[model samples]
Target chain A: MAASKCTSLSGALTRQLLDSVDSVLFDCDGVIWRGDQAIPRAPEVINSLKKNGKRVFFVTNNSTKTRQMYADKLGKLGFDATADEVFGTAYCSAMYLKNVCKLDGKVYLIGSNAMKQELEEVGIQPVGVGPDPISGVQIDWANVPLDKEVRAVLVGFDEHFSYMKLNRALQYLCNPDCQFVGTNTDTRLPLEGGKAVPGTGCLLRAVETAAQRQAQVVGKPSSFMFECVASQFDLDPQKCLMVGDRLDTDIMLGSNCGMKTLLTLTGVSTVAEAEANLKSECPHRQRMVPDYYVDSIADILPALQA
Target chain B: MAASKCTSLSGALTRQLLDSVDSVLFDCDGVIWRGDQAIPRAPEVINSLKKNGKRVFFVTNNSTKTRQMYADKLGKLGFDATADEVFGTAYCSAMYLKNVCKLDGKVYLIGSNAMKQELEEVGIQPVGVGPDPISGVQIDWANVPLDKEVRAVLVGFDEHFSYMKLNRALQYLCNPDCQFVGTNTDTRLPLEGGKAVPGTGCLLRAVETAAQRQAQVVGKPSSFMFECVASQFDLDPQKCLMVGDRLDTDIMLGSNCGMKTLLTLTGVSTVAEAEANLKSECPHRQRMVPDYYVDSIADILPALQA
Candidate 1:
């Protein structure tokens, strides 16, 4: 299809869009809250969507937080969300590898315990392969033996990562059949004080360039994440609306999966910036322009009522 | 020509190869000492080459260390060297921007004091644009107000980098005429106590990908670094033998500049690994084949005497 032109949807048109969608996927970071504080009218818009019989699901590429943690944060922000109503990249990554990739082999995971637990819950065993692990062999940089059985490489944000771990991971990726997977490609992670180190995306790119291989990213921007969500919730992509702040991840995810994406100016990107980027020749530019633009979630109530 | 089929050269052949070379360039990190520990017999091999009436220069992509620092390290490791004998990426980068690119205007330098000093020496005024500058303009991340006066973007290793710094760099690169220059592309830097962090190369790749613009890398692997050395020392590329452990940076530099490359099995890459990479279908694979493969620098002493 040709690039979708930006149409200034009237109040009537906004109401039509709101009423037509059966499922609404909300990006947690920018759409709901800016860091910790809730964005203006976030709770009201979400409550209104729920009242109108919409299945509200909080979806995020931030693998640092678990579903329960997201639910707790949402409940505290007055959005009235349950643990089951939230989905994250960690969840989708585990599901994709289990279902689509059909990878039942040994996986060298490089994330938190939450990622490990999620993989286990899906009948897949997760093993840490850097220095210390429970079951599988750990490739200690101080003493890297170069194990031959390592079949796959899975990466996420691990604060305890060492050079030896990275070197061993590169060795594993050197093998042709070894699959490379990542939970998400978020460059920056939100910290309590300020933004800390970038996520696994940076490291993944290094390995990808060195090995000359493209990794199968199972997070946002990958249709697999949305497919997993739709399969679990029984929601049709055509009738779903994805609300997000970041253009690369959340917005691209919605567009790639054939879902309507609403760009909120409250998070990582602004409308003017998005418009300028849309004019650029970036491959992901066309996939970024959202179906609708809004200043904040509070504007959603009036548009839905109209 | 014809991929230089004679790999394992005899003693007389090695002497002939050395005699044919007027100058020799070596990469410091993987080629010589990898973070203080000299590769076995590297110093001896270099000394032997010097005794054979060949001018030897240390050309490295390591921008973090200045020429004086390299000289000190080499001196301690039994290789008699002075500051003039060593050429770093910082030196070549400054030369390229000043002479080739003709960037005489103000530059926002994203590196250390050594790099800044080099740029200033080359008549390019260094300006700080990041949030915290020890002695330059504070880098403004959100809105990089780049006027027409800005000539180039000089990137190096900065430990105290922020997202805003990267964002501003991208903004500067967005300008069609703005020259994007990087000191090197080494992904990680070796730290004290066996630790490593993302280096300037990692940051450079991020900006390069976002801007969709290739950076003119002034460090190792680039023929520009070798060109700077050859011009400064009045040497010829055809008579020069570039000796380094890593094939990508050292060997590629020699190959691109029409010099003989020697691959050692001491640092980051192994002999088997380099052979596999040399035979790969990758475009970089055809750069330079090692004229000779040996376990350490000690192997070169006998050949030089013969």
Candidate 2:
């Protein structure tokens, strides 16, 4: 942990790191806030960064919310934000289908209405949201009427994921040409009281195992989410800094997309873990190390002060 | 592919192979019956073998049926099958927990009520059989009340498998001591019209990935099912001739349990698959090759009739 590896100090080096970045990307729920509560002075730090003419953007793997919902939450949390600046997996996934995959048919979406709304916003019709009930009898489960027009299967956070849906996804994906897309491969969702639940990764793996195929992930660490931000804002990677608390998702995404990374330790991962990773022999683990470390996003407020 | 490998012919070599075994194990679907119809003269062949003092038993990886249910199906299809003669994975899994794993606590079963019935028959109280509804809000998925009595998590053919159940299983399995067991890892269940649905293996792999641990599977190819049959019948594995349809599940189970295997083509796999495995360079695939090939279980009829 050298002083040079930290960009929080009010000095020439810290100012230089800040001066080189015109675009600022933030990961929600950890770096800016934890759960329902906003991190102390995090909103102020973000507002200050925006005031300095830095294009502040929110990059989240959370597929459960639409852009409008994320904008509403940001407004309520006292963070000066807009829907256009938010790059959620839900919106990015839809954007990915449109801009990158260039799919012509509807999406066999195994996600939520929020994701459906996002996909529909981009003119990509998403089918198979909500509950797909099972027919108690053993009538050829593989024979579920598949929509021939579905050219892709988009996986996200679905609360109603079931055997029927998983089977249908597998059946549809049997076509080698059918595209498979995932929101993110987050293994667990951390809850209050140190509890956790299965995330999109669990559902995605189930379908992958059954279908025997891989999904093109459109979330953090995949470069798709960052690409969404970069393509939309026309921001240069060298001039953009990604700030998040998680090393695997947010920080890895920054490094993966050739952008500077700032790790704030107000949420999941700790400094000790990052230091160990930096010294690890495994190249994959080493890549997850951030360019800089901070105790909290609030630490950056001092560097931005007059 | 050679005539010498054919066991259907009434020759000296065929008779010698049959004479070497005093016990006979038969797979249910595609071996004795196809869907709801009994294969012509298959039941007659089994009756003749039983009349000749050969120990007859039914072995299957289908976890959907209980022993009693299987016996009823067998009776309806013209086979004289007792509950003791049937060793479905549903029953064998419960037996594996009771005998092999020596589990003393209640089981968190992610399967049907038939599995629960089998567990109860073995005096092992099974919980978590039906739907586990989510709280809708994503506040605390990990905080779902876990039962201390739950000592093992058994995965089987569960139609009601949901995110909440999977999360709860992961939460409970987070305990290092909790045993993880799967009935079988059959990837797909073939239905009428050549349609297929995901089997227990898909569900099992999902849990295995989330828990980051392997489950001790108690179905075909694991030898646990044959061990159950042998322990119940007091028969030697060397003296048993296992008859099956699928090369992977049934024939492999036979090979793993040190029993001679006979493959019939009325089910999932074809003779070309068996022949390919027989000549496979990989020893793992070679082990799945059956000792003899028959066109159908009816191929054994003339041997039994004479």
Give the number of colliding residue pairs in candidate 2: 0
Model 2 off-target regions past 4 Å? A1-13, B1-11, B275-280
Candidate 1 lDDT, B94-203, residue by residue in tens:
88998889886877677767777777777888776333421221222324455567778888875434334455565676678888898988875544353444456766
The digit string of per-residue lDDT tens for model 1 on A65-111 reads: 67777788888988878988888877777777778778857677767
TM-score of the B chain in model 2?
Answer: 0.95
**Cα misplacement distance, residue A225 of candidate 1 (Å):** 1.3
Q: What lDDT tens digits, residue by residue, belong to model 2 across residues B1-306?
A: 223442443456556766788999999888898789898998898888888778899989999899999999889888877998999999999989998899999999999999999999989999998777666577656667889999999999999888887888899899999999999998887776666778888898878877878999988888778878887679898898889988888888888888888888888888788778767799898877888877777776666656
Model 2: per-residue Cα lDDT over A122-224, one tens digit each: 8999899988877766665767789999999999999888888899998899899999999999877776566667789889988887887899999989998
Model 1 deviation from the true structure expressed as Cα RMSD, one decimal place: 7.7
lDDT of every predicted structure (CA atoms): 0.71, 0.86
Per-prediction TM-score? 0.68, 0.92
Evaluate model 1 with DockQ and give the value: 0.11
